[model samples]
Target: MNFEYSFEKISCKDVENFEKIRNVTLPYDYKQFLLLNNGGKPIKRRFQSKDGKITSSLMMYFPISESVEISLDEKYKIYSIGKIVPSNFLPIGIDPADSLICLSVSGNDIGKVYFCDMDYFEEDNELKKEFISLISNSFTEFTGSLYIPE
Candidate 1:
């Protein structure tokens, strides 16, 4: 079962909902802390849907969580800018059915296995190229060196 994943557009309004989920799921305050430290910049380069709703958001921040080294057994590889950073301020989301129920996860290192309720994205080569073109300054090939189970 090979599943493909693509990025999606996220808006400022989506940030508010994401914040609510983060506050509840995370042990410590992630939203406020991220704002103070990294100015809370959202990764809007890659997007799937164009409904002005962010189906997913990948944020970059200073390494705060314990760093996990990539090894032979590692499954995912996340190549961040500059250095190998661990972001404790992770991506959180509000369950569409139950807004009260918030699901959050942190420390999604490279070669990590994730089993969750994320809507699988179909890969569009053209769209991906467009996104890469848009963010020429921050483009890094996801070298398929690691076997990421689809």
Candidate 2:
């Protein structure tokens, strides 16, 4: 499977469009994050098959800063320096913050979306693939976000 992703900023105008999907998938906290960072440029990537049918997707977000010093502080780490939005959250009309958005568009159907610290790469990678497979095979939609508190 080819995993290609990007990030884009979410604008205030995009809120309702985002909410359309958010209502079905994301929780309140995720919505808050989107609203707070809509002003900045958020990364966005498109995932589709060779035939052009997008089966799955992923989004990553970055923070905004008025000054270099303020942006580079420790607080950046606490928030989604990497705003990772799941495929289930896609077709999202919101403009994301200005940051790097890593995305993947796959042929397999997506089930659940998980958000973990970047450090959990190995586990997230393995699980992401597995979740894709599960959704493809069963056509089941896994709801909710799995937050591993830092």
Best prediction by TM-score: 2
Best-fitting candidate, scored by lDDT: 2
Give the TM-scores of the predictions, in the order they appear.
0.18, 0.24
Compared with the true structure, what per-residue lDDT tens digits does model 2 show for residues 8-90?
A: 44554455553353343334443445555532322233322223232333342332233432221122232222233343323
Task: Let me know the TM-score candidate 1 reaches against the reference structure.
Answer: 0.18
Q: Candidate 1, which segments miss by more than 4 Å at Cα?
A: 1-16, 20-24, 39-150
| lDDT by residue for model 1 (72-122), tens | 011112211111212221222112321110112343332221112223212
**What's the CA RMSD for each of the models?**
17.4, 14.8
Question: Which regions of candidate 2 deviate over 4 angstroms?
Answer: 1-13, 21-25, 39-59, 62-150
